[model samples]
Target: MVDNSQGHSAYSEDALLVSRMNVKPGGKQAHMRDGWFMRDGVKVIQQMVYPPDHPEFPNEPKGMKAVLAECGLSQQRLRGKCKKCESDSLACCYKRILELQADFQEQKSLMQEVIESMGHLSIFLLKFTAS
Candidate 1:
């Protein structure tokens, strides 16, 4: 049996009486009862969010199994999830900081090289002028 637990308003009789002229044509606006359209004993309820076990869900946490079993609904354990997220964010931030530090070191070295070359040019100009 199709799960109408989400409160779809589809009727069974319309599907069986397909040839009857009075039967509403099947569509979103067709056999609508209780805010849902009927199509072969199935209600046209939106099914965007699949269960956690579904492959489309992606990286379903082990903690989610407990939530589904206990509450019959999917819920995140924010305490643990948030902690892990914060740790990952911190790691990313540290990695970026190290990269920036390396870039800054390279720029500083280039600046030092330019300053030394300018000093040598000044010394050469002074010696030639003195002669």
Candidate 2:
């Protein structure tokens, strides 16, 4: 039990569980802290910060250059492909990469803006109150 201005209250397992925000794939990347459950080939729940020193995993390529590199079809490989399907395959892969890049950029920019704006706001508020 702990007390301050407010009266003391009991703490229990339920309280601990309720405060946790589980960040699983369906709930992944939420801008809040959550506890996650782990299971086969997936994390059922994920915490806000990844576990300490977590190893990075492979992510799907999201740019034209990255896709071409992953598919082993860089400029040289494209040249080696049969003429009939050469342009078609390249166009398809390029389109996919552009789509991925668009999505990734949208998400990345939004995250950056949110963090910066919030940090600035916090600083301003602190300075304002201090004066």
- Please name the candidate that would achieve the greatest TM-score relative to the true structure: 2
Q: Each prediction's TM-score against the native?
A: 0.14, 0.19
Model 1, 35-89: lDDT tens digits are 1223466654322123556654332222222322232332233222221233335
Q: TM-score of the candidate numbered 2?
A: 0.19
- Judge candidate 2 at residue 124 and give its lDDT: 20
Candidate 1 ranges with C-alpha deviation above 4 Å: 1-95, 98-101, 109-113, 119-131
TM-score attained by model 1: 0.14
Query: RMSD, each candidate, Å?
Result: 30.6, 18.7
Model 2 residue runs over 4 Å out of place are 1-63, 71-91, 101-131
Whole-model lDDT for model 1 versus the true structure?
0.27
For candidate 1, the 10 contiguous residues with the lowest summed lDDT are: 16-25
